[model samples]
Target: MLITFIISSALLTLITLAPLLPSNHWTVRVWEFPRLQIVFLILINILLMALLIAQDLGPFLALVIVNLCLLCYQINWIFPYTPFANTTVKMSKSSDLSSRIKVINVNVLMSNRDAHKLIALVEQHQPHLLVTLESNQWWQDALEPLHDAYPYRVNYPLDNLYGMHLFSRIPLSDITTAERVEQGVPSIHCIANLHNGKQIQCHFLHPAPPSPTENEESTERDIELLGLAREIANKQGSDSLPVLVSGDLNDVAWSPTTQAFLRISGLQDPRIGRGAYNTFHAQYAFARWPLDHIFHSEHFELVSLSRLSEIGSDHFPLLTEIHLK
Candidate 1:
């Protein structure tokens, strides 16, 4: 019984972490691989445990081979090859970066009290562009001091979970809610004019989380963002303007769909070599992952990226500085 319990717990742990495995096989990965492999292993374990309870050794030993294969395949998680890994290869050729830009993204839990923490973080980072998710009128009021620092603002603070506010030191032109899906669930799309006369088309999004309370299915949000990413990729192959799509994607970086988003969008993940800048579940440090992200087109270079201190919310603020060449 003890051995059965041990095997069951181990298998459950493996299943949970399975999705974080690397997916650059040029074959199959993440959802298609890990999720399938995990389900198969869990069933096998259950069958083997039942056999063991019945004093059946033959089936248990046969299941051992399946367990071994699953364990071996699990090694892909040791290193995830994201676009950030590709940065070094292109660095030598990017020597003519003219101007730099800084961006900060945060998801302040709608009912959080540490509004001052976010305010201080903005003051400290002094980012050129800032985006806050799950914000309401209360949050907007708490962060009012930032209005002076960032003269140009696009505030849409609503009680709904989709509320988002964007503050930028640079001039934001043609500011409007992106019409990817429908109303209520808002996403900000704007063209930012930098001090260097360069302009970047930016998309700040907060997709619905795949939880029972928020969103029952993730299809709409996933497809909406993917469609946006695909549009950006089409532009990337022709245009010179920098493009960035950022916010809490609510999906793991190593997921198969996210990999497809990368393949389809042609955007680069900024957290490859930097390690997982886990920024959720602030109260429990161990229960966090890099839900917040900043993916950019090839027209920019990363200057710096950081996860700010806890702001009494469920997520930590992500600050990124980049230079356009």
Candidate 2:
């Protein structure tokens, strides 16, 4: 029992410090996703060590101190997302419908055939904008009915899982499909003309993730994200246009890359004080993280943010409502 406790503690400690290294290798970056899970394991480790307290006070005390420090470190990064923490984006009290924009972002697994489930959500929410990732030609055909409701559209359907589609009820202008890093993977940029005569710059992205099969390193993903951040920062400096960036970033909210993107883009995360709003791996309750995200400039205030029901995909849809302030 003591040996098992020691091994678990050692492994947990290693995982806690692995991401601290300055490496973009998939092995290192993948460790960043399971911080919450690690926290849970740490608690269990502490409890097990407490049960073996009679064995040796010295080693037990050492392990407890190290685990406590790691716990604090992990909590510090995720603290802002907890309900106890103050919200980064202010709540909106406005009742004006024209100034409000409700968006639904989903990563429909390329192979998943239950398109009707997502169609149901669009019908139920009646969102101003809908963004889908991993959408192929078949998925596009499946969602053809949405054309009437979402007249302004930018479709870039591909067999590759990085395919994206942006459908909007609001008038979209200056729409462009950009490949920031890789040639095939594309990102969407457009201007959404709100009913209140306000225009917001919207960016939709579905960057490749660092994984054994997808990307051995996070270089391309980081380059794409940071490049967009720099452009948004430059544009925001001259004109404070309300900017909305949403999609499957393929990076967790607490990751260093995502944090850098937030800092550079000057966009606010609505999930910061509300909840994790985990959207990926919908089939697995224990193995889920917030891979999908909706970030907007400070010019918008939060109306509501929620994780919608499963749609037969690995990722659940993320529904967000923000008021253009």
State which candidate has the highest lDDT: 2
- Candidate 1 lDDT, 1-325, residue by residue in tens: 6466566746556565544555322222223323433545665675656666567555466445555555455434413533344343133234443477789999998999788888888888789998999999999898888999899998888898778999998899978886466467788998999876889989998877555576655566677778887787777646557888888877666565677887888778777755667777678754555778888877777778788898988888889887776
User: What CA RMSD would candidate 1 show?
Assistant: 6.5
Which residue pairs in candidate 2 collide? none
> Each prediction's Cα RMSD?
6.5, 1.2
Give candidate 1's TM-score: 0.79
Tell me the number of clashing residue pairs for each predicted model.
Answer: 0, 0
Q: lDDT tens string, model 2, 1-325?
A: 6577678878988888889888989998898998889988898888777776857767578778878888899888888878998889999999988999999999999999999999999999999999999998999999999999999999999998988998999999999998878878999999999988999999999889999999899999999999999999998765668999999999999999999999999988999878999998899999988999999998989899999999999999999999987
User: Against the unseen true structure, what C-alpha lDDT does each candidate score?
Assistant: 0.72, 0.91
Badly placed stretches (over 4 Å) of model 1 are: 1-68, 71-78, 81-98
Report clash pairs, candidate 1: none
